[model samples]
Target chain A: MNLNIEVNNNVLTAMPGDTILDALNRHGMNVPTLCHLKGLMPSGACRMCVVEVEGRKNLVTSCSEPVMDGMKIQTHSARVIESRKTIVELLLSNHPDDCLYCERNGSCELQKLAEDLNVRERRISGNKNNYKLDVSSASIVRDPAKCILCGRCVRVCEEIEGVSAIEFVGRGSKTFIDTSFNHGLNVSTCVNCGQCIMVCPTGALKEKPHIDEIKTKLADPTKTVVIQYAPSITISLAEEFGFKPGQNIGGIMNAALRRIGFNFVFDTSFSADLTIMEEASELVHRITTGGTLPMITSCCPGWVKYAEEFQHDILPNLSSCKSPQQMMGAIIKSYFAEAEGINPADIYSVSVMPCTAKKFEQQREEMTQNGISDVDAVLTTRELARLIRLFGIDMDKISPELADSPLGTRSSAGKIFGVSGGVMEAAIRSAHYFITGKELIKFQVNAVRGLAGRKEAKVMINGLEIGVAVVSGLKNAEILMEEVRNGRKDIHFIEVMACPGGCINGGGQPIGTNEESLRARMKSLYEIDEHDAIKVSHKNPYIIELYDKFLGKPLGHKSHHLLHTNYQERDVN
Target chain B: MKSKVEEILQQYPNAGRDSLIPILQSVQESLGFLSEESVVQVSKFLKMPASKIFGVATFYNQFRFTQPGKYHVMVCRGTACHVLGSATVLEEIEKYLKVKPGMTTKDKIFSLEVVACIGACGLAPVISINGEFHAKVTTESIQSIFETYRNREV
Candidate 1:
């Protein structure tokens, strides 16, 4: 039943269990909120959403208060506005005075709230917090001094990600969010998914940017700086450059990177095609040779780390194929360098990823071969956009160009690897070929597609029924894995991406991207897949050539050394 | 200490959210304080985040994170005690014992605690040395009180 209520003299209807904030939002009445995250339980800790109600002595936080029948509320009374202004001013008093240099300078929610409420002068003055920045994690940075104690990061980490790597420590005014025992995140069971950075309203939580390292390598003439962009980056990168979201700026991005002093630029999708050739062959080998059943995709480094920490027993189940970025790095240093007669040590390989975990992934010991690391520096899609701006390149005037040859060609199946179920769909296409020696009539496995946290399907390939599951977000993956651990032998293959919507919504992409932008980016990939002639990775000419000339075959001796790696169990403690 | 915590945790085979406070209380009562190890154990037992356990434990004054000394000293800082120069008495005790509130003396003879009120308004400006209340305590009386507890047998 719906209850009729009056908000600021307007009659509104609210459903049962709807908070006052919910009713107000339904009526298009906006109230200032900081600690309140939609789809999460209302915390009411911020007190910025307080509204006056008739017969109530004190202002009540609309987010936590349920709308009762005939409850007259004043959402924007002078008193309420004054109270919200004071709350913002108090937060500013203790916050650091580094907005000019902060990562969220132009996009900070708290700063925007101050502007909305017209908070000009600071009425309250207090000593600023002197907490040291926690820079231990390769993916994220924690600046406690800038934290406003909104508890958004803590809630998102615990509630959504199900990785309670951080929580509020101490009490009252001395309170701050930190991992258990105040140790840095490297010691904690942090999966490095970067969800905390995605929800942070302020600059308190941010990706550990590698812009300077990329620039330093670019300036060094001895280092032949080469960069590769992830499959999802081209679609999502447009949003940062003032272009509409999901505009395929792949060609323009290539033109921009060349102007920024890059010696060469390649597509990670090419290696994604290469990854499929290896991944599908490995799956086929497992199925035929009585190897580990239910092989899990290890493309997402964040998920690999999660498996290492929480589900060590499942480590053997993870595919040994390195992520497309790492695979590209491996080939570039060995195969690409050999072709050009350049010393591998003199080459600086950089990757522009749609993920923050790639920064951690490139530094993995397994990713290095014979004293040379595959990839040198990893930059987020946001960092690439920042570099483009730093070079003062005019995006509008630049002509569209193609990526460098040799490693430039990729198939539509490889391009779809940016989204959640993309890897499984791509692998199934090629795995069918590997097993039956013929391509499937239908290229797309419609069952394993979209933004759902988890998807499962059964496919008959060469009369062998293969059970497959695709999961995004580690929490969702844990549920599917628990079923697998219980000896449920139906599933034979699994794909796990730590980021909820896959690399399109990766942590390293443009920050503050909503659902609309995610759909747009995902749609762009699907469109590219639909229009391209080469839809199967096994059919890509370069991949076939690479296997014939340099490598003997998929899962062969040289392929194993250059492209594959192993993972070890890690202690959460 | 480890066995005691494990025993308490074992009592609740499938503890949920509601069992946290009682578990914390039981652990603190048995061990005289909640250690980091006990907190971690309780978090695992209840399936609660350690930060939440610490947050809940710190909210109540009954739970102490550190061990209490053999002779726990409590000086009242309530309104009635403050009106009777209890601040000076507390300062004198801290100076003579060389320990601040919530800290134990090097010799383990005394530990200082600043309590809000002991509900003995008539005995204003009172200091309790190991639960033995001293009424109408003054700055000069703190030194003699320390001497009395320091020389006592274990």
Candidate 2:
């Protein structure tokens, strides 16, 4: 068989069995496609990648076709270009024309395709999309008006996350994506993870805006507005301000938040350290006292909701510690309110997170005391960038500033909670100390680090083997849940995150980012851990002070009242 | 009816994900239409999300959600019937019954549904009521046929 295929007067290497799209893509052909996700099986529903081939009756969809040896292919012939242009025009005809008001106006893939293809006019027209917008969920809004039916969100939700919250409901032209029985998202089995928002090409899916309420709070003179940011947002949010991906802009971010009318700024990672402290002691207590064996970490609100909806039987295995976002929010109202002489009612608590699910988690009935919610509002990384822009805070001109006293300082152990295996590693560090009263020879548990969806490691604390598993993305977590269901007793601890690669690449971070950027963010967290002097959560002075001054100890009564809560089985069926 | 659905699910002991279609078909055959509870039961049995099951079930015309009315009406819209003016017959029935295709009347006595073919080309413009056939129907004669079913006569 011939080894080469002619393309536009140039011979490119074409593997015998590779699809033409793959061959072209591999050899640096930048053919645009709307429905093709790199690793998934191509649906080929959209003909955007269609190419003209010699001796073919119609344009061949490059994504679905296998390359034949010595087959002549033209990726951008006049006919192919016209076909692609027509496809875009048709999609635009049905799409909403309000781009200026759209959430994805600047970053929309369809808008980019329209520009790249030089689509100048409405050459074709069709009935416009008049589907109703679904704003029932607190974390996400689904506007069917702008959906181009790329199926990316549906594919990722079903194939990767294994939560088919949305699906193509009808057939043919009547086809539209909907929840079960075309119901509202709130009643559906959606975990509010916002992975759908990350995959959506248009503004059809977006984080439910908390910006208006935040604006109201920021402008209110009576309310003392205090804000905290998640561990992952520090590194991942830098890219939103045109900084290099994974740049640690934590100090500048604190300064920016202060400029945006927040009276006080705090770091969520401090509470992450607090979470580790409570969670570690809880693990040791459970293991020693013959409580639940495989105690799952509950740092990720998305994973917690998923467990509540799908794996309700194993709710006993979940650690009752509140997530760092809620932890800091609760503390800001309770401990910080008392110390600063501010009433909990007057203090408006806000958190910036790399997750949309944090919005849902903040409003949980358990995360409230005396009708006062811990977190008043939550902003995604993208929304924070929008806020910074709206306030005209020049990130480049801003000087770095430290977070406020008492609730700000954190160890690298808490900071690395941005990554997937971070919680397990942090908890193990404190658990080892809590158990043996000594530090591990090395602070870094390298076995459970990096971008893998799942990782396992064994730890020896005084010759008692402790087996641990860390999984991000509910699909990966499903495997371990099945094992536990089938009575596998060897595993003792589990860490689950709803988004893959952890909060650094969470659904509420920057949209349309590649894997390389995620790797950079992951690498930055590890690097921070590597260079920091305080490697363990137990070593943070503020945490030790917090325990000594206010909360008596881990798993104490006050800690249970403030930092720990129970989860119940949520019926999704 | 819910217990019958559960019993139907139990028959397929090897009921995994792929067995969903057969289970859905069996349940629908016994119950006449798919119910919300049946879909949830199928979800539990197959260990799949109910949304996924609902989605797959809605893709085909063979599966339906609403329960059939006491006297289910089927108007054949096949090529032979359409050529013989079954469209007008369907319109008359819809007009008389005051319900569209796949919907039941408010009183629960009559249901109207359109089918592609009844395989009786010789008896063109045919409609079936509770599996009993009526041949060569028209707009004028349609109201009388429904009156006969309403009166419980042959």
Candidate 3:
């Protein structure tokens, strides 16, 4: 059912229920939007996509209005443009005067709209709402002064993430976004996934940066600063340096970190391999010894915290293994310090992650071993890029270099841990090996692959039926968790990554990220898994050597002391 | 408190998103205001997030999060009241009581509120103190109103 529509004096075909915005977008018409999230229900709050339709007196919002047959639409008429400009001005009149020092100074949507609409002069000015900045959360900061009431953060928090940690509070002129009872986010049931920060178009919401602390530590001559980056950062960091997305910059990233004054740089993927070795062995032990039936992966800190806060009943089900970042931190301070003969106190451990929750994870009391903190500081991928730029390191000109030895080497299976289903796939590859002592005939589990929100797969290992489920986005995870709560007994293993599309689309990734970049990042990880010779974590000689030398075996007494930790059921308040 | 909220919530069926506002209103009415415990209980009953319940409850003027004072003073700031300089009257009241709208006096005797209208437009610039309406209020008359409330027996 194709309907003809005249858009901006050009005839365009639309589907039966296609909106004018949809038809125009299909025809390559560029219309700006602020409150419009990609897949969520259309909320015509921003009024930025308002277009004039013939036979209609008022300019209807194209996002909400459906295209009628033979309807004429003008996307950018003088009247529409003026209305948008006025709206921008009205928003600006209430916004703060701190753009020069704002985190999203260049990337703010309100700032961009003002420039696009040529709103140079302030036509209207009045009393701006002076709300205090909320810096309570470990991962995110909320400044109500910069909020334009776009409701993107509120929607993303509730709709996409299912946290609903924050919402629109109060009425009309006094309306502001806040958690329940006007308490800070730290007290709220915020899992600190930072998805709200990623969707926020302004500097109102941003990752709580530890850049100053990192810089101070780096400059300290006595401190031996070491940094480890997550696997997803390698593929996504290239975008920050003006390179195309999915460019594997692993070696160059090592070189860049070297130039940025880090004494040592290691890859969290090595620990990711180490994680599979332990996690897979744990799953096998659980199946054989009548432990927890479906052991959930605890690699994602966001998911771990969610379990601690909301899903306390499922705590026993979570694999007792710390995340790869924490694992690397533990081994670096203990194993690496023992080998290098450096004092653990002097080693300032830092990690660059594709997540904001890593900051919270590193600070968790359970992550500490023997009263000494494992990781000193955690930086998001965005923060690492800032450090690179601050040091004036030319990423493109730097020659490729490998990571530091012993805790550096990793399998391609570990590298794919950055994407959704990769953890389950990697764990399955090793879990099969742990159970049967042979590699899977088909290492590539096509069932658990791709960008599905919730994925399920069944595999037979040594004639033993195994059911596995992979879920990303906490909302999607909640649906599967509901089934688990309802006594559904099919699944034997489950992997939950809080951010949608896994770490490739994590909250701390580059801003303005769309579907194309997400696909590219996921493809790059799969490509590494395809091309690399060592595809399985069990196949990684370094992992086997680590067990032979320091850690006796996976889930052994020594490994449990160093690599594993417990969770505390936190108050939901 | 838990038993009261549970009793009010038991009237609604097991699963319904639309029951949130009504449940919240009932809980607020029974408890005098929605406490953190009441909100959490409502969330458990309806299986809704507390943040969202707060979002809906804060939308209407009929609901109040804080407990009302013994002598709740609601000053009208409607179109007629505004034209008659009710803003000055509100300022005088705030200065005299040493409290702003949405805040109770330190003694807990008076709580100030700015309402849109009280439907007594013919008597423009009205201020209601504990169900008693004073029409055509002025900045000068604010002192006498507070005096009357202060001297009155509870």
Q: Choose the strongest candidate by TM-score.
A: 3
Question: What is the TM-score (0 to 1) of chain A in model 1?
Answer: 0.97
In candidate 3 chain A, where is summed lDDT lowest over 10 consecutive residues?
A: A16-25
- The CAPRI category of model 3 is medium
Q: How does candidate 1 score on lDDT? A: 0.89
Candidate 1 colliding pairs, count: 1
DockQ of 1: 0.38
Clashes of each: 1, 0, 0
Tell me the lDDT of candidate 2. Answer: 0.90
The residue pairs found clashing in candidate 3 are: none
> Model 1 chain A: which ten-residue window has the lowest total lDDT?
A155-164
- Tell me the tens digit of each residue's lDDT in model 1 across A1-573: 899999889888999999999988887889989999987778999999999999999999999999999999998999999999999999999998889999999989999999999988878889988899999988889999999999988887777667788888777888888887677987787888787888788999888888898889889989899989899988998999889988999999999999999999999999999999999999999999999989999999989998997788999899999999999999999889999999999999989998888988888888898888999888888888889999999988999999998788899999999999999999999999888989899888888988999999999997889999999888888899999999889999999998888999888888878888999999999999999999999898998898888988999999999999999988653
Model 1, B4-89: lDDT tens per residue?
Answer: 99999888877888988898889988988888889888877777777677777766667777678889889999999999998898
Model 2 lDDT per residue over A65-113, tens place: 9988778999999999999999999899889899999999889999999
Tens-place lDDT per residue, model 2, B1-154, is 5499988987999768988899999999999999888898889888888888888988887887888899999999999999999999988888888989878898889988888898987888999999999999888889888999889833
Query: Model 3 scores what on Cα lDDT?
Result: 0.89
Off by over 4 Å in 1: A1-29, A51-60, A65-74, B30-33, B61-77, B80-115, B118-154
Better of 2 and 3 by lDDT: 2
TM-score per model for chain B alone? 0.89, 0.91, 0.88
Model 3, span A119-150: residue lDDT tens: 99988997886999899988888999889899
The C-alpha RMSD of each candidate to the native structure, in angstroms, is: 3.5, 3.1, 1.9
